[model samples]
Target: MAKAIRQIKQVDPAPEEWQAASLSAVVKAAAENGESLIKLLEIIKQLDGMGVLNAMEGLLQNRVDVAEIALGQLNQPTMYHVVKNGMNVFKFLGAIDPEQLQTILSGITSGFEKAAQSGGQESLWKLGKSMRSPEVKRSLAMMTGILAGMGEAMEQNHSLPEGGTDIG
Candidate 1:
């Protein structure tokens, strides 16, 4: 048996040696993932060719100014309303059934085509008679229903004076 060890000395690696070791590990990993490394290189080449890399580098260098400009634009009341209206539009669209919306759009397209073909000179009597048709009745019902629903939503969501003032 050997005598008990008095001290343990740890030798720190030189900077160059440490760098070489790290590079060797990276090389080994790149070898192991040759296909992925090639694909990544290809993407980098394409981005560089398109000047996207340059743009990104510039953006990174001036990120503080870019952020300030963006924040200033978004801080406006108009921007606030725009963002709010966009969200409401998205919500409204999401609430509708896609198939029902498609049907409605198709009907509107067909109606427009028919109206165009009619030369817009139909007499009031003819228009009144057309209202008796099932298609016209169906469309009118849909419009009135939409109006009623919109009225209900307005009443529920807004606290307007007797005759509403247009804030828009």
Candidate 2:
């Protein structure tokens, strides 16, 4: 029988050999991805021409300082409210029906155009007569519904102080 193995010997490549291997692998990759490498080079050239590369390099070099400044700005009371309100607005929008919102926006745009054509010259009599129209009545009903919804939401969200009346 052969003698049992006592240890293992590992061979390590010299630094020059390692460099050559890495270069060969990179050359093979370049050959395989010639088109992508060309596009990447073009993008790099455009960014350099626009000074974006230099700006990015500077930003990276002072990342800690830039982060500190950003954090400091974000920690301000106004920024806190801005971020909070922005998130709330996003949530509110997310809850809306996009098609319904689009219809409403288009209606508002058309109303503005009509108003411009009228040049705000409509008499009180005409305005009063318009209230009898189905469109006006529908708009009024929508407004009333909105007000009712807002009242309900406000009552749910805000508590009255001790002995405070709802008359206000």
TM-score per model over all chains: 0.69, 0.83
- Alpha-carbon local distance difference test for all models: 0.94, 0.91
lDDT value, candidate 2, whole model = 0.91
What are the per-model numbers of colliding residue pairs?
0, 0
Q: Locate the minimum summed-lDDT window of 10 residues in model 1.
A: 159-168
Per residue, candidate 2 scores C-alpha lDDT tens digits across 1-168 of 899999999989999999999999999999999999999999999999999999999999999999999999999999999989999999999999999899778878988999999999999999999999998898799888987887678678775455544455
Stretches of candidate 1 off by over 4 Å are: 1-17, 109-129, 157-168
Model 2 backbone overlap count: 0
- lDDT measured at residue 96 in model 2 versus the true structure, 0 to 100: 92
Q: Which candidate has the highest TM-score of all?
A: 2
Tell how far residue 25 is off in model 1, in angstroms.
Answer: 1.9
